[model samples]
Target: MAPKAAVLVPCLLSLLLPFSSLALTQDICVANLLLPDTPSGYPCKPKPAVTADDFHSMALAQAGPTLAPFNTGLATATVKQFPGVNGLGLAATRVDVHVGGVVPLHSHPEGSELLFVFKGSMTAGFISAESNEVYVKEVREGELFVFPQGLLHFQYNTGNETAVGFAAYSSDNPGLQITDYALFGNTLTAEDAREQGHLRRKIGGDEAQGLLRIAEILKLIKVFFGLSAVPPDGRQDYRCSLLWTCGV
Candidate 1:
């Protein structure tokens, strides 16, 4: 990666470092991300211009959403309020489904969804009516699919053209809580999962099994995102169990 040449600011680093060093390290430091509100969209700061660097730390838009690997387009709203997202009530995002594509089944144990199809034909639905656990369905565009909290759902491409969709969720980090992921590809081993079915946690030392499972998820996430391990002192759960760190 090339070194950034800096975003032509009017202030001297020597002078502002004492007063604005906080902007570089603090989350919710609105010195930058929250662009000045204006009548026509956001007004650019007239001086002390902001660059992609300003939002890079907390937003995925730094990379301009997915161009590949996603097999379709992806954009996130968590990236918008991230520096201040902690404890916030909601988050939103958009994902485009390509022709002959499918969104693998998943659930948000902590959130629900309201997806609106904006273009092309698509089939989207989620588990509804707890009694039989049926998924309510919607076909064609300009329609909606609402998944009650904790229900599994999926969307499939059904049109000749690419399908565009918007997904709104209730949590900041709504990961792929697919049954397979939680049961197999996660931070819990088969033994650990077995214990979960009982009323109490099994008390015993199977250190190797526990370590192996956590390592599996952590290592995979690290390789996927090209990250080093989370720092030891205050890290929790997975590298992305979510965070709100400050002054630690």
Candidate 2:
């Protein structure tokens, strides 16, 4: 009888474990931004201190200031700015592009993005990672587009006036890397770039054309960041060499 009772007790405990776990689950975990974040997300605010205001934010209500070269502004509502989205796996950004402006090549490593146009029009595109083929479309007011995770993409204002769009991400804190800034805005030495260039050519080919485009991009980055511009003589090798050595 004792042996039979022990086995039955174990079975009953196993059956009740799920209910105990569910009882421990939380309804919401509004972020406690004052604390350091973890791999999963910011720690939850104390229930006593959490409030309705934590879930509401005006961070994206107004157009952020535009900057030169890109003539673009961004207002983001991520966990850091909005506190309520931590561990929620969602965030938003407002993009405003003036006439003739562009949001340059960039990628979000952590999340897929969806853009909804609310005003004016813009041309948007993302490069296919598997085939390297470019896919583009002109999105106007009330239209939308999706960019898959970690793909290089861009948006350009194609209309006569300002273009405004709201972008949402599948992550509470979508990581961002602008291609030009990642490449030319760093402290990497010219030798490091040269070594990496060899591998790039072996994989993609057309090293010469790639170098030309790189030089042009470097010049634009330098000018945009208020650094000295590359010489206008346009000698590809000379321009690239000087720009690299000067750490542009």
Candidate 3:
């Protein structure tokens, strides 16, 4: 009977091992933003020190400045600003677009996005990387559209009035890269840019036309960043040739 009892005790302990381990494991990892970020995410804040405020945020309640050429305001709330979302695969953005405004072509390298239009209408689209095919649609109020991860996408206010929307991202800190900014807003010199454009033109045909389009877009980006001025005739007037020269 003693041998049987000992065996039963060991089996019961083994069965409870996983439960005990889970109990000790952390269920939430509120971010410690002061610490440097890691590959996985930010380090967890002290659990005892965490409060309900850590999980709540109003960062996306207001619209950001729409001073750029796109006339789009973006209020982003990610793990960096909302510490409670740390280790949680979620982030959000409030988008406000004026009439004739656009979000411009951009990509989220780390996450896909779901954009829901709650006011007015927007024309949203994404370009496929493989085929370069465009998938576009007019999304109105109460409708939603999706953009796949790592694909270039844009939102334009095609409606008569101003448009507003909210975008939810799959990543806690989805990285954003606007195509025009990547091409023109960098610290590269104009000479370097012209050289790159020349090389792309050497490919000929549509590639050459694409390079031309990039050149035209460069002026708009430069103006948005205050690196250039817009003449009364609406032509691009360059004040500086090099981005680094302007101490940007």
The residue pairs that clash in candidate 3, if any, are none
Q: Of the pair 1 and 3, which is ahead by lDDT? A: 3
RMSD of model 1 against the true structure: 17.4
TM-score for each model:
0.46, 0.72, 0.72
lDDT of each residue in 84-185, candidate 3, tens digit only: 887677899999998877887889998999999989999999999999999999999999999999999988875679899999999899899987678667
Error of 1 at 3 (Å): 68
Which residue runs does candidate 3 get wrong by more than 4 Å?
A: 1-25, 193-226, 229-248
Higher TM-score: candidate 1 or 2? Answer: 2
Alpha carbon lDDT at 88, candidate 3 = 73
TM-score of 1: 0.46
By summed lDDT, which 10 consecutive residues of candidate 1 come out lowest? 239-248
